[model samples]
Target: MRIGLYPGTFDPVTHGHLDIIGRATALVDRLVIGVAINRDKGPLFTLEERVEMIESEVAAIADRTGCEIVAHPFENLLIDCANDVGAKLIVRGLRAVADFEYEFQMVGMNRQLDNTIETVFLMAEAEHQAIASKLVKEIARLGGDVSKFVTPAVREALLARVGRA
Candidate 1:
C-alpha cells in the first residue's frame, strides 16, 4: 500500500488544507494527516482540539476517497513520524511561488534526513489558492469573518479562541 504523510500544524484546518488533503488521497492508499506540535508556530488551538477538528472535517470524505485519511498528532521529527506510520510519500501543497520556495528548502532537508521517503507536491485548487492559516488567524483576531476560509468547526474554534463566539 502506498502511504503518504501530510504534515502540518493545522492549528485550524482550512479549506485550502482540505483541498490538498482531498487531492493527495487520490495518489496514495492511505494519507496520514500529521498534526505537528510545534511551539515556534504559536498555534491558536491545542493539539487535541486540532486533531478533533481535523478528524471531524476529514471524516465524511475520508472513506469515500479511494484512500483513507487518518488524522493524528506527532511531536517528533517529521521523517520519524512518517516512518512510524509507514508512510513512503510526504504530501505538500503549493499555493504560490513563495510557498514553493519555502517547501523546496524543507523538501531538501527532509530528503537529507531520510532518502527513503519521497515528497509529492500538489498545487492548491484555484478557489483556495489564497487562503492561508496565518491569514485566517489574523482575520479572526481582528474580528473579520473567516467563515469562507475555514470549515464551520474551525471557524467556531477560532471564534471561541479569540472570544468572539
Candidate 2:
C-alpha cells in the first residue's frame, strides 16, 4: 500500500488545503495529514484544536471523495514523522515560486534525513494560489467573511478563536 504524508501547521484547514488533499489522495493509497507543531511560528489554534479541525474537514471530504484521512501531530522532524508513519512519499501543494523555494529546501532536508522518502509537489488551483491560513485569519479577524475560503468547521473555529462572528 502506498502512503503519502502531507505535513503543515494548518492553523486552520482551508478549501485550498482540501483541494490539495483531494488531489493528492488520488495519487496514493492513504494520505496522512501531519500537523507540525512549530514553536517558532505561534499558531492561532492549539495542536488539539488544529487536529480536530483537520479531522472534521477530512471527514467531510471523505464523505464526498471516499478517501481515508489520518491526522497526526509531529513535534519532531518531518522525516521522522514520515518514518514513524511508514510513508515513503511527502505530498506538498505549490502555490507559486515562493512556495517552491521553501518546499524545495524542506524536501532537500528531508532527503538528507531519509534518502528513501521522496517529496512530490502539486500545483495549487489557480484560484487558490493566494489563499493562505494567515491571510484567512487576518481577514476573518478583521470581520471579513472567509466562508468561501475555508470549510464551515474552520470558519466556526476561526470565529470562536478570534471571538467574532
Candidate that scores best on lDDT: 1
lDDT of 1 by residue, 40-141 (tens): 898888889989988899887787785788887899999999999999999999999999999999889999999999999999999999998999999999
TM-score of candidate 1 against the unseen true structure: 0.95
Instruction: Please provide TM-scores, in order, for all candidate models, with all chains considered together.
Output: 0.95, 0.95
* lDDT score, candidate 1: 0.91
lDDT of 2 by residue, 73-127 (tens): 9999888999999899999999989999998888888788899999999998988
lDDT, candidate 2, at 161 = 84
Note the Cα lDDT for every prediction shown. Answer: 0.91, 0.89
Deviation from truth (RMSD, Å), model 2:
1.2
Q: lDDT score, residue 26, model 1?
A: 85
Candidate 1 clashes between residue pairs 3 or more apart in a chain or in different chains: none
Error of 1 at 80 (Å): 1.2
Q: After superposition, how far is residue 16 of candidate 2 from its true place, in Å?
A: 1.0
Clashes in predicted model 2: 0
